[model samples]
Structures are given as structure tokens and as C-alpha cells.
Target: MESQQSAGSNMDNGYVSGDNEAQMLSSGAKRGGWITFFFVSATLTGLMIAGWGWLTNLIVYLIEEFNVESIDATQIANVVNGSINMIPIIGAVLADSFLGSFHVVSISSGFSLLGMVLLTLTATLSSLRPQQCETGSSFCHGPSKLQSASLYAGITMASIGLGVVRFTLATLGANQFDNPKDQGIFFNWFFFTFYAACVISSLVIVYVQDSISWGLGFGLCAAANFIGLIIFLLGNRFYRHDKPQGSPFTSLARVIVAAVQKRNILLPSESKDYYHEQDGTSKTVATTPKRSFRFLNRAALKTEGDIHSDGSIAKSRRICTVQQVEDLKTLIRIFPVWASTVFLATPIAIQTNMTVLQALAMDRHLGPNFKIPAGSIVVVVLISTAIFIALLDRFLFPTWQKLTGRSITPLQRIGIGHVFNIMSMAISALVESRRLKIAHDHHLQEQQGAIVPMLSLWLFPQLVIVGIGEAFHFPGNVSLYYQEFPVSMKSTATAMISIVVGIAFYVSTALVDLIRNVTRWLPADINDGRLDNLYWTFVVLGLLNFGYYLVCAKLYKYQNPEEEVER
Candidate 1:
């Protein structure tokens, strides 16, 4: 009876016990340290500062130092950004499927450090970069093949490092906590630290690069990367490392194959006809598959030859359990909501790059002493995002819960983000309209590279609004994916957002190129082009995407509804 009782609990929850559970539990003084958060956060902060230090100023660096053309610089930046966001999927795959988060992060940080060092060398060694190209030069000198190779090698390494660090760091930090509330708190602080790092990099690091020396700026990044890597290594003992269970993706694929193979065979309705396993030794879940996605249920069907002489599942590599089949169904059901986020992210990606271009053309003065760096302007979005994240996490959520007697769901948070994003794009359109009007008044349409009398501050409201939109959507999408995704693919859940952003950026590049070719809306000289039209296009896209999101959200059923809560 004692064994039966224990087995019964196992059959239902499937929660692993013994050392797996023990390793995760927060113990006494020796185990979890508040200082652990400080060390890891510090490490991550250092890496973030190092990363953005160079990246934010990449456009300027390419044009000034590498002597690349403006359109070419923009294309390179988009591709680099896309690559940075895109490869996190590979990192997440490594984390969830094989190497685990800690090892991958450590290895990637090393790569980041090396990249930073290389970039520092590139900045210091004049031969590694092209001669300074004046803005009005008839023919600007481009980077030589050797210089280009060296430059690209460094960029590639840094991008790889950033891809690994992005979501894997979140997964690592969250692993430190067992309680859901603690996990939430960690996420809040995690993103805050991330944004805070970006803010400092934008203001301080970017200022140094623009106003001071690029060599010094690049060297500082190298130093930060070194310190961060060292600190992360030092705190290795304190981390509650989660081990990777062999790839869930492979198992999911196997289920599809098995189901297809068994498609002609009718799915068994009888409870006993399905394989119910408590350690594969006892029954659970009534041995019946859920009715939804019934085609997949065939994978879980038990046949006479499938079991061994002692009732064990023989050669089980080709077959799947009912839970596995259901897990696949959950992914299938959630895919529409997942797909919707790609379009949701597309406008933001385009706007981010375009806003930088807009800043370059506007008067960027704060009093007589200082000129605001063009790269730093987008930090407005980061600042707004950081502020709203704190407000939503600290105040808004609790208040909403108290008034409603229930927390807001991720879906609801995402829905709110869609509205704010639309508002942001509309505001962007209006601001661009004003800037274009000023250009027309000054008769500067034909003047290539003309700085309109319009204050760069005019661009602030749109950025801030988008920042607010990001504050909602970024966390909402991450939280939703983390909650809805299977346990084995938790790292991948975070990476899914990166995946969308990556694809969106690529899409944005295509759109930008298409616009340049087909419409007069985006020419080499943005001052002469109709950027307002582009923003309006995004507004229309946002509305359509929002509508699609609602339909998907309405139709979807949560696999584990109880776990998804706002608070």
C-alpha cells in the first residue's frame, strides 16, 4: 500500500524525485546566496555593456572608420542584428537538448571576450580599418579585403556570444529558484538588469565612442567582458545547475513519424488499449488520450506485439506514450499564437533601424555643451521599457489582481501590447510628417544629408510609446512561452521571441530594400524620401496582426491553464 501510494502520485504528476529534486531545493547558508544574484547579474551586466557598447555605434563605426556607404551600413547592421537574435535558437537547442545552460553560457562568454578583444584591436590598428571617409566625398574608400575579413570575423564572434547569452542567461537565473514567485521576481530583476545595462551602454559607452575615442571605447568593452567572464566562473559553485534531458525536439519528431505510420489504424477509445505508465510499471491518466488532435493520439496506442513478455514496452524507441502525444498537441495548438508574434515583432524591428536614421537627420542638441549621440536616442525606448516593466511588475499587476480577484493572463498582457504598439506607429507617422514638413519649409528636399531644424526630441514620443509597448509585449511573450512550453523546452521558449525578432528583422530588410526599389518612400537620402508612409504602413500591419492575435488567443486552449498567472 505504501509503494502503491507513492507510485500513484508519480503516475499523476510525473514529477521526478530523489537527487533530481534534492539538487534543486534551496538549502541553508551554504547553498543559495543573495550574493549569487549580484554576481550573476553583475556578470551579465558586464557582458551587456560590452555588447551594446559596440553594437549601438555600429552604424557610425562602419561609415566613419570602415568607410562603408550609408545604405550598405544600414543593411549590414540589420543583418548583424538579425544574426544576433536568430542564433539564440541554436543556443537554446544546445541548452535544452545537450550541453545545458551553464556550460553553453560559459563557453559563449569566452567567445564574446575574444570578439571584444578583436574589435579593440580593429579600433586601435589603423590598417584594420579604411581611411576616414568625409560625408560629401564623391567616392568613399571601402574597406580592403583583409580589413573586411578581420572586421567581419570579430562581428561574427560577438554576435554568436550575444545569441547564446540572451535567453540562456534567463534560464540559468530562473533555475536558482524553485518557487514560482521567486522565479517571477528573478525575471523582473533579470530584464531590469538587462535594460539598465543597455541604458548605461547607450549613454556612457556610446558617448565615449562618439565624443571621445573609439579605441578607448572598444578597450573598455574588452575589459568588461573579461570581468564578467571571471565573475561568472567564480560563482559557479553557487548555481543550481539544471541538467538537460535529451532533446525534446527529437522526441516530438518521433511522435509525428509514429503517428503517421499508424494513421490507417483507428485510435483506440478503450482506456486499457492505451499505454499508461507510472515508471511504465503502473497505470495513470486512465490510459485514454485526450480527444483533441485525435490524429496524434494514434502514436500512444498499445498493440499486442508492442509490449514485452513481462508487460514492459519493448523497443519503445519507435513508440510514444500518451503524454508525449498530448505534449505534441499542445505545441500544435499554441503555434498560431506563436506565429502571430512574428508580425507583431516585424514593425518594431523596422522602426528600430529607421529611428536611428531619423535621429541622424534631426538636430541632436541638449543645450550648447552636448550633442546627444544618434545611437543613444533609441535608449529612450529602453528607458521607457525599463520604467514600465518596474511599474507593471511592482504596482500595476498587484493592483489589477486586487481589483479583479484574479491576475491578468499573458494573453491579456500581449493584447494590451498590440494596442500600444499601434499607437506608437501612428505617433511615429505623425512625427515623421512634421519632420518632412520642416524639410519642405527649409527647401532641403534636394539637399543630400541635410539636418532638418527639427529637434531630435521630436522623435522621443514615438520611441517612448514603443518602449511602453515593448514593456508589455517582451515580458508577456516570454512569460507566455515559458509557461505554455513543455518543461524540456523551457530555454527554447525564451529563444522563441528571439527567433521571431530575428525573422522580423530579416523581413524588415526585405521591406526596406523593396521600398527603395519599388517606391520613392525610401531612397539613399531619407530626407528626400517619405518615411511617414512607412510608419503608416506599419500601423496598418499592426492592426491586422492584432486582429489575427485575438482570433488565435480566443481559439487556443491552455495545456496547463493553472500555471499561467499574471502575478
Candidate 2:
């Protein structure tokens, strides 16, 4: 019966056989399809705008509003960015193991709204913040304990809310599609919309925050979060909710446990010796375990007292199905590739935080009348990424396929990203060298907070290069994980990239602290320090990491080589 349903689901083009059709019929329309795309995309746009609004300018906010030191503010921003990326794994686990994505997203959005409201209050009520300092004042008052607590609380809630919603929403949207090609397209658009929304927030909301009023800016963010939540709830009926399977981690743990318990026992010699499943009907399960991880095969070896009369496992902890063991093996096989992304992301993280600090000290005047917001400088990267994603998906990818007689593999895309990332770092080093020369020539090195004569546009080339790299890697990582991971871990798989980013940010933070303590390259007054040397360090690291990635990519054997070839 299970096999029949699985076959039927495939025949129906990925929709589960009975429940989906019944749900569609009962609603008098299809429940999950392109119809839900608009609602999801719109909600994503609103939420992303809300998230980026406060986040992009966070370092400046902490410094100017709360009287935090510049380096301290940057560290705080790094931790906040790390937290926002790190918390998604928890949300993904909850979505995959207990609550569905809809519930997780809805509840998280409400938390985000509450957080934004808190932030707005802190900005509006003078009592909630430190006393205002005079421009160029030698002495500045820091936030009181109570004020500090309030600020941190708001940041914590907002971070949790935004973090949880980011990739879980991606998984939710991807679940609407059945075909792999459609899912790939959705990932592309998902990132495109994400970066585009960030660009808007960086330009519009960051400007409002920097130029107008932080209170008004935060209020706007709160409103956007509210609207996004409402829109998501309105489309509830149209969304196809994947029921939570009890903790996948538990099954994975069982595989390890069973393997250890049966380690003394000899490996199975025949397919009949291994337990497939209770039904013994899944064609997808291999008859024999692969040779790569033969030690784990002991977990599937069916000894006495392993099975009951009804074909159910009598001792599940002591023995698992071959499918479970294989699932664990798949994760093991992909571990190296996943590890490579961490190094790839760390340089980008460092560059992201450092760029803002550089911008604050650079000449930002656009024309005679207006000065660009320091935080908004990152918009160059976002805009570049958005444009490149569209071009890659619609033009470059297809053209490559036509010319090469095969589609561009995800690993290949990631490799391209690595090359571009290295180039971006080298360019950053050269640009910083020029900026430092200008600062020295103008005799501005001794003056703290003095803007150098260098134009901020000089930073755009490196940022644009990094953005182009992101265009290749971000979706490539998502597509690779989604396609390669076990079916039970789909949400978790999409969130893997978040893990990479989260760990990268944390690592970047540590690296920055180490540099500040050990060397004079990243002084609070960067004009007096060797900022170019720091970028040179990143370039070397990027080159070494890229070489490591090449090795991993070379060794990795895709689980579905046939499917890869077909693509």
C-alpha cells in the first residue's frame, strides 16, 4: 500500500496521492501551486524589508544612539548577524520535527512585529536611551543598564523572529512545487526577491533612519512586519502544509546507536540479511548498502529478535532499516562540501562588516546637495546580486547548457563563486590601499571621525564583485542541498546555507577580535590603521579556502549522478 501510494504520488507529478487531491477538490481549487506564489513572495518582500531596515544600520545605531564604541558596535553587529543566521537551524528543526513551516513562520512573524515595536519605542522615547552627545564631544554618556537591557531585548526578539522566518519561508515556498526544475526556479526567485527587498531597505529605510528619524524608520519596519504576517495568514488555506515528521535527528541518532550496538556482529553478506522496511516494498531503497560506509551496514543486519511476525521492528534501537542507514551515509558523504561553504562565507562576512566602517570614514557626498548614508553603501552588493541572479537564471545557465551539451552543475557554480570571491578580496585590498594613500596625503590620519577625501564609490567595485559571487553560490548551495539531502530533512537542508552563514559570521567576529588584539590593522580609527593589510589577509585566506573547495568538489560523488547528468 505504501509503495502504491509512492508510485501514485510520482505519477501525479509529486503531489501526494490521496490527501492533496481531496484537499484540492474540497477547496474547489488546487491548494498548492503557482497560485500561492504571489502571497509567499509578497510576504517575503515585506518581511525582508522590515528585517534589513534596522539591521543594515545597526552598527551606527549602537554607536550614535547608544554611545557604544566603534569597535564594540562592530562586534555587536557581528554577533547580531551571527545570531540571526544561527537561529534558523532551530526554527528549521521545529518546522521539520514538530510544527509545520506555516505555524513556525506565522508565530515568528508575530515575534518580529513585537520586536520591531520595541525597537520603535526605544527610538521614540528618549528615556529609553542614553543622553545625546554633542558632535565631536570628547566625553559621551553610555546607555544606562535599564536602557541597555531594553535595546538588547528588542534586538534579541527581532533577531529570533527574522532568523527563523528567512529560510523556513524558502522551504515553505519550495514545498508548493513538485517538479525539481520548478523548485530550482523558485529558489532563484526567492533569493532575487530577498536581495531586491534588502536593496530597497538599504536605500529607502536606511536613509530614513540615518537622515529622518530612527523612530519613524522603526515604526515603518513594524508596519511592514504586521502587513507581512497578515498576508501570510490570509493565504493559509492555499498553502500545502507538510505534516511534521517526528524528529529526524532521533532517527539519525538511532542509526549511530544501532551501528555501535551491532559492531561486534559480522557484516551482512546478502540483501536478504538486511532489513529494508516494515512493508519491504520501497523500490527506492537499495537492496544492498553501498561500499563507501560498510561499517554502518551492521545497523541494518537483521539478527534474532529484530523483527516481529507483522514485519515490524521488535527492537528499533538495536536495528534500523537500510534506508535510515543510507540517509545517515548521505549526510556523511556531503559533509566536506558543507564544511567548505563556511570558509567561503567567512571572508564575505568580514568584508561586509568592515566595509561599513570604511564607508563611515570616507567621503560619501553624491553631488552638491546630498550625502549617501553609510549603511546604504552595502546596497551596491545587493543590487549587483539581484541583477546577476536574474541574468544567470534566464540567460547564462541556459546558454551554457546549449554550448556545453550539459547544464552547469551546482559545484561548478560554487567554484565560479569561489574565483569571484577571491577577486573581490584582492580588489578590496587594492582599493583600501588607495584610500589609505589619500588619507595620508590629506594629513587626516590623526583626526578621529574625519572623512577622507576618497569617494565612497571606490568601494563599489569590490562589493559588486562579491555580489556577483553570491549570485552564483547562494542558490547553488540551496539547490545542491535540497536535491541531495534525504527527503525527511528538506527544511533542514534548505537551512544548511544559513548554518554556513551563521558559523561564518561568528568565525568572522572571532577573527576580527583576534586581529584587533594582535595587530594594529583594524584600529577603531581605521584611517590610522592598515586597512589594506586586512583586505590582503582576506585575499590570502580566500585563495587557500578556494583551493580546499576545489579538492572537496573533486572528491564529492553526487547521490544521484544520473539526475545530475540529466540536468
**Which prediction has the highest TM-score against the true structure?**
2
Off by over 4 Å in 1: 1-35, 278-287, 310-312
RMSD of 2: 2.3
- Model 1: per-residue Cα lDDT over 150-177, one tens digit each: 8999999988997789799887776555
Q: Which residue pairs in candidate 1 collide?
A: none
- Residue-level lDDT of model 2, residues 1-567, one tens digit each, is 121234335334433322334334443555567888888989999999999999999988988899887878888998999999999999999988888789999999988998999999999999999988853467898899889999999999999899999899998888877667778889999999999999999999999999999999999999989998999999987776776767889988998999999989988678989888833434444498888789898898989998887777888798888878888999998999999899889889888888998998998999998999989999999999999999999999999989988989999999999999999989999999998999999889888778998899999999999999999999999999988987778889999999999999999999888999999988878889997888888788888888889999999989977657655
Worst 10 residues of 2 by lDDT: 1-10
Positional deviation of 464 in candidate 2, in angstroms? Answer: 0.3
**Candidate 2 structure, TM-score to reference:** 0.96
lDDT of 1 at 101: 78
